[model samples]
Target: MSIHVVLVHPEIHWNTGNAGRTCLATGATLHLIEPLGFSLDEAQVKRAGLDYWEHVDVRVWPSWEAFEAELPRLGQPYFFSTKATQLFWDAPLAPVEGTVLVFGRETGGLPAELHERYADRFVSLPILSERVRSLNLSTTVAIAVYEVLRQQR
Candidate 1:
């Protein structure tokens, strides 16, 4: 069984790196869609991922279109967005091998076009306090990954 994590237009290297580490820990694959805000080769990214960066199963796609073309073969996709009405736990996230969890950039979340197009596929984490805007990208990824793992267990 495998979990695929897709990060679209990610702007932070540290988040990406941490996400990579999470993916590595969970035996998940990481797919990154361009254009990225920071270089993958940067020291900050390596620092965040530590020496495990090299072991992460990461695939960098040229664009969303490029990645979308391969989506069917990858797995059933569930887009993560704060704007979604459905709670993630309520979603039919299963068959770990067939599940694909897609996340957006740190600053903007997913593109508005994506939100509109995949409205039915979107799922969200609960944010209890009104004072908080959103969780960190890496934190969100970690929680989502573990939730999927928890469900499988």
Candidate 2:
């Protein structure tokens, strides 16, 4: 059983590092689609990941097209976005192979094209406060991935 966490066009290294830590904890593979905002060697990133960076099974993609081309080999990917009408809990997150959870940039949710293409797979975490825009990227990934672990166990 494996869970795959994908961060597309991620802008913040700290979030990415933190997400990696979550992936490490959950036995999930971490895939990063590039044009990254910060270097992986940055001190802050290392700080966030701490001693666990070496343990993370991380893969880097050159672009969205490159990553999308390899999607078939990866497995069933679900897009997480604030715009989605479906709630994350509604998804059948069975502990299965090639289960990819894709998240977008911090400020912007996901590319409109992806949203349009995989609209049915998109799910959102409910935000109780009207003033908040969205949850932290790492926090979202942790929550979503854990849900998969919960269901599988």
Best by TM-score: 1
Q: Estimate each model's TM-score.
A: 0.94, 0.92
Global Cα lDDT for candidate 1: 0.90
Which residue runs of candidate 1 sit more than 4 Å off their true CA positions? 42-49
lDDT of each: 0.90, 0.88
Clashes of 1: 0
Summarize candidate 2's per-residue lDDT along 1-153 as a digit string, tens digits: 678899998998878888999999889999999988878774755665567888899999999999999887877888999999999898886635568899999988789999999999999999999999899999999999989888887
Residue 140 lDDT, candidate 1, scale 0-100:
92
- Residue-level lDDT tens digits of model 1 in 10-118: 9988788889999999999999999999887758565555688889999999999999999988878999998999999998777645789999999899999999889
Candidate 2 residue 132 Cα shift, in angstroms, is 1.7
